[model samples]
Target: MADELAFKRWKSLEPGIRKKLESNVFCRKCGVTTIVDYEVEYTNSQFTLKGSCQKCHGPVARVVD
Candidate 1:
Protein backbone atom coordinates (compact mmCIF):
# COMPACT_ATOMS: atom_id res chain seq x y z
CA MET A 1 0.00 0.00 0.00
CA ALA A 2 2.91 2.33 -0.37
CA ASP A 3 1.54 3.91 -3.51
CA GLU A 4 -2.04 3.55 -4.58
CA LEU A 5 -1.26 4.64 -8.14
CA ALA A 6 1.50 2.12 -8.40
CA PHE A 7 -0.79 -0.58 -7.10
CA LYS A 8 -3.38 0.30 -9.66
CA ARG A 9 -0.79 0.25 -12.41
CA TRP A 10 0.36 -3.17 -11.29
CA LYS A 11 -3.22 -4.39 -11.29
CA SER A 12 -3.60 -3.17 -14.86
CA LEU A 13 -1.00 -5.58 -16.14
CA GLU A 14 -2.06 -8.82 -17.79
CA PRO A 15 -2.52 -11.77 -15.47
CA GLY A 16 0.26 -13.74 -17.12
CA ILE A 17 2.73 -10.86 -16.81
CA ARG A 18 1.77 -10.27 -13.21
CA LYS A 19 2.14 -13.94 -12.40
CA LYS A 20 5.58 -13.97 -13.99
CA LEU A 21 6.69 -10.99 -11.92
CA GLU A 22 5.26 -12.35 -8.68
CA SER A 23 6.75 -15.81 -9.08
CA ASN A 24 10.30 -14.77 -9.88
CA VAL A 25 11.33 -12.69 -6.89
CA PHE A 26 14.81 -13.32 -5.53
CA CYS A 27 14.90 -13.87 -1.80
CA ARG A 28 18.34 -13.85 -0.22
CA LYS A 29 17.31 -16.49 2.29
CA CYS A 30 15.25 -18.62 -0.05
CA GLY A 31 16.72 -18.05 -3.48
CA VAL A 32 14.14 -17.39 -6.15
CA THR A 33 10.70 -17.54 -4.52
CA THR A 34 7.21 -16.42 -5.23
CA ILE A 35 6.27 -13.15 -3.62
CA VAL A 36 3.21 -12.76 -1.44
CA ASP A 37 1.55 -9.99 0.56
CA TYR A 38 3.26 -7.37 -1.58
CA GLU A 39 2.89 -3.66 -1.89
CA VAL A 40 3.73 -1.51 -4.91
CA GLU A 41 5.86 1.57 -4.86
CA TYR A 42 6.67 3.94 -7.69
CA THR A 43 9.89 5.94 -7.77
CA ASN A 44 12.23 7.18 -10.45
CA SER A 45 9.72 6.17 -13.09
CA GLN A 46 9.93 2.54 -12.11
CA PHE A 47 7.80 0.10 -10.17
CA THR A 48 9.13 -1.71 -7.15
CA LEU A 49 7.41 -4.55 -5.41
CA LYS A 50 8.08 -5.10 -1.74
CA GLY A 51 6.81 -8.27 -0.17
CA SER A 52 7.58 -11.53 1.57
CA CYS A 53 9.06 -14.70 0.18
CA GLN A 54 6.46 -17.37 -0.39
CA LYS A 55 8.78 -20.17 0.68
CA CYS A 56 10.28 -18.83 3.90
CA HIS A 57 8.25 -15.68 4.50
CA GLY A 58 11.37 -13.56 4.38
CA PRO A 59 11.51 -10.05 3.02
CA VAL A 60 11.76 -9.79 -0.76
CA ALA A 61 11.62 -7.14 -3.42
CA ARG A 62 11.72 -6.82 -7.21
CA VAL A 63 12.14 -3.82 -9.48
CA VAL A 64 10.19 -3.61 -12.72
CA ASP A 65 11.11 -1.02 -15.26
Candidate 2:
Protein backbone atom coordinates (compact mmCIF):
# COMPACT_ATOMS: atom_id res chain seq x y z
CA MET A 1 0.00 0.00 0.00
CA ALA A 2 1.09 3.56 -0.60
CA ASP A 3 2.39 5.39 2.43
CA GLU A 4 -0.12 8.22 2.10
CA LEU A 5 -3.18 5.99 1.99
CA ALA A 6 -1.80 3.72 4.67
CA PHE A 7 -1.31 6.61 7.05
CA LYS A 8 -4.67 8.10 6.23
CA ARG A 9 -6.58 4.87 6.68
CA TRP A 10 -4.82 4.11 9.91
CA LYS A 11 -6.01 7.40 11.30
CA SER A 12 -9.50 6.91 9.90
CA LEU A 13 -10.05 3.55 11.55
CA GLU A 14 -11.99 4.01 14.74
CA PRO A 15 -10.58 2.57 17.95
CA GLY A 16 -13.69 0.45 18.49
CA ILE A 17 -13.47 -1.03 15.00
CA ARG A 18 -9.78 -1.72 15.43
CA LYS A 19 -10.30 -3.40 18.77
CA LYS A 20 -13.20 -5.45 17.50
CA LEU A 21 -11.12 -6.68 14.62
CA GLU A 22 -8.18 -7.47 16.87
CA SER A 23 -10.33 -9.55 19.19
CA ASN A 24 -12.24 -11.28 16.41
CA VAL A 25 -9.36 -12.77 14.44
CA PHE A 26 -8.68 -16.44 14.98
CA CYS A 27 -6.47 -19.10 13.49
CA ARG A 28 -8.42 -21.47 11.31
CA LYS A 29 -6.11 -24.38 11.92
CA CYS A 30 -5.65 -23.86 15.58
CA GLY A 31 -9.14 -22.68 16.35
CA VAL A 32 -7.86 -20.11 18.77
CA THR A 33 -7.32 -16.39 19.10
CA THR A 34 -4.34 -14.99 17.23
CA ILE A 35 -2.01 -12.10 17.70
CA VAL A 36 -2.20 -9.70 14.78
CA ASP A 37 1.15 -9.37 13.11
CA TYR A 38 0.19 -7.19 10.17
CA GLU A 39 -2.80 -5.66 8.55
CA VAL A 40 -3.61 -4.63 5.00
CA GLU A 41 -5.99 -1.80 5.65
CA TYR A 42 -9.09 -1.16 3.59
CA THR A 43 -8.38 -0.76 -0.09
CA ASN A 44 -10.42 -1.16 -3.25
CA SER A 45 -10.19 -4.93 -3.21
CA GLN A 46 -8.24 -6.40 -0.32
CA PHE A 47 -8.99 -5.99 3.35
CA THR A 48 -7.25 -8.41 5.66
CA LEU A 49 -5.66 -9.03 9.05
CA LYS A 50 -2.76 -11.44 9.30
CA GLY A 51 -1.50 -13.00 12.46
CA SER A 52 -0.22 -16.11 14.19
CA CYS A 53 -2.03 -18.24 16.70
CA GLN A 54 -0.92 -17.52 20.23
CA LYS A 55 -0.79 -21.24 20.91
CA CYS A 56 0.29 -22.82 17.65
CA HIS A 57 1.93 -20.21 15.43
CA GLY A 58 -0.48 -21.04 12.64
CA PRO A 59 -1.33 -18.28 10.21
CA VAL A 60 -4.77 -16.71 10.33
CA ALA A 61 -6.78 -14.07 8.47
CA ARG A 62 -10.03 -12.20 9.00
CA VAL A 63 -11.91 -9.76 6.80
CA VAL A 64 -12.66 -6.39 8.29
CA ASP A 65 -15.07 -3.69 7.38
Candidate 3:
Protein backbone atom coordinates (compact mmCIF):
# COMPACT_ATOMS: atom_id res chain seq x y z
CA MET A 1 0.00 0.00 0.00
CA ALA A 2 1.07 3.56 -0.65
CA ASP A 3 0.71 6.65 1.49
CA GLU A 4 -2.65 8.33 1.12
CA LEU A 5 -1.01 11.67 0.41
CA ALA A 6 1.07 10.19 -2.41
CA PHE A 7 -2.02 8.59 -3.86
CA LYS A 8 -3.66 11.99 -3.88
CA ARG A 9 -0.79 13.32 -5.94
CA TRP A 10 -1.19 10.52 -8.42
CA LYS A 11 -4.84 11.45 -8.75
CA SER A 12 -3.83 14.94 -9.79
CA LEU A 13 -2.23 13.73 -12.99
CA GLU A 14 -3.11 15.39 -16.34
CA PRO A 15 -6.57 14.76 -17.74
CA GLY A 16 -5.36 13.23 -21.00
CA ILE A 17 -3.38 10.59 -19.21
CA ARG A 18 -6.22 10.05 -16.81
CA LYS A 19 -8.67 9.45 -19.63
CA LYS A 20 -6.31 7.09 -21.34
CA LEU A 21 -5.90 5.17 -18.12
CA GLU A 22 -9.62 5.01 -17.51
CA SER A 23 -10.33 3.71 -20.99
CA ASN A 24 -7.59 1.15 -20.89
CA VAL A 25 -8.53 0.11 -17.34
CA PHE A 26 -11.26 -2.38 -16.58
CA CYS A 27 -12.90 -4.41 -13.83
CA ARG A 28 -10.90 -7.31 -12.52
CA LYS A 29 -13.87 -9.65 -12.50
CA CYS A 30 -16.17 -8.35 -15.22
CA GLY A 31 -13.47 -7.03 -17.51
CA VAL A 32 -15.58 -3.94 -18.10
CA THR A 33 -15.11 -0.20 -17.79
CA THR A 34 -16.23 0.04 -14.19
CA ILE A 35 -13.26 1.87 -12.85
CA VAL A 36 -14.12 5.33 -11.59
CA ASP A 37 -10.84 6.05 -9.87
CA TYR A 38 -7.32 4.83 -10.74
CA GLU A 39 -4.06 4.89 -8.78
CA VAL A 40 -0.76 3.10 -8.47
CA GLU A 41 -0.54 0.89 -5.46
CA TYR A 42 2.49 -0.65 -3.73
CA THR A 43 4.90 1.44 -5.77
CA ASN A 44 3.09 1.10 -9.07
CA SER A 45 2.88 -2.65 -8.99
CA GLN A 46 -0.92 -2.57 -9.08
CA PHE A 47 -3.63 -0.12 -10.08
CA THR A 48 -6.57 0.54 -7.79
CA LEU A 49 -9.77 1.98 -9.20
CA LYS A 50 -13.08 3.00 -7.67
CA GLY A 51 -16.65 3.37 -8.99
CA SER A 52 -19.52 1.35 -10.41
CA CYS A 53 -21.38 1.34 -13.72
CA GLN A 54 -24.40 3.56 -14.20
CA LYS A 55 -26.19 1.02 -16.36
CA CYS A 56 -25.72 -2.20 -14.40
CA HIS A 57 -25.57 -0.55 -10.99
CA GLY A 58 -23.33 -3.39 -9.92
CA PRO A 59 -20.29 -3.18 -7.63
CA VAL A 60 -18.50 -0.10 -8.86
CA ALA A 61 -14.73 -0.05 -8.89
CA ARG A 62 -13.12 1.98 -6.15
CA VAL A 63 -9.48 2.70 -5.35
CA VAL A 64 -8.43 0.06 -2.83
CA ASP A 65 -5.18 1.12 -1.32
Residue pairs with colliding backbones in model 2 are none
Candidate 2 error regions (>4 Å): none
RMSD of 1: 1.7
**Tens-digit lDDT track for model 2 on 39-63?**
4555665466666666677777776
Q: After superposition, how far is residue 28 of candidate 3 from its true place, in Å?
A: 7.3
Off by over 4 Å in 3: 1-3, 28-31, 37-45, 60-65
Task: Give the number of the best model, judged by TM-score.
Answer: 1
TM-score of each: 0.91, 0.61, 0.45
Model 3 Cα shift for residue 30 (angstroms)? 6.6
TM-score of model 2 relative to the true fold? 0.61
RMSD to the native, candidate 2?
A: 2.7
Candidate scoring better on TM-score of 1 and 3? 1
List the candidate numbers ranked by TM-score, top first: 1, 2, 3
Show the lowest summed lDDT stretch of 10 residues, model 1.
Answer: 1-10
Candidate 3's C-alpha lDDT? 0.53
- For model 1, residues 1-65, the per-residue Cα lDDT tens digits are 35988899889999999999999999998888999999999888788999999999989999999
* Order by lDDT, highest first: 1, 2, 3
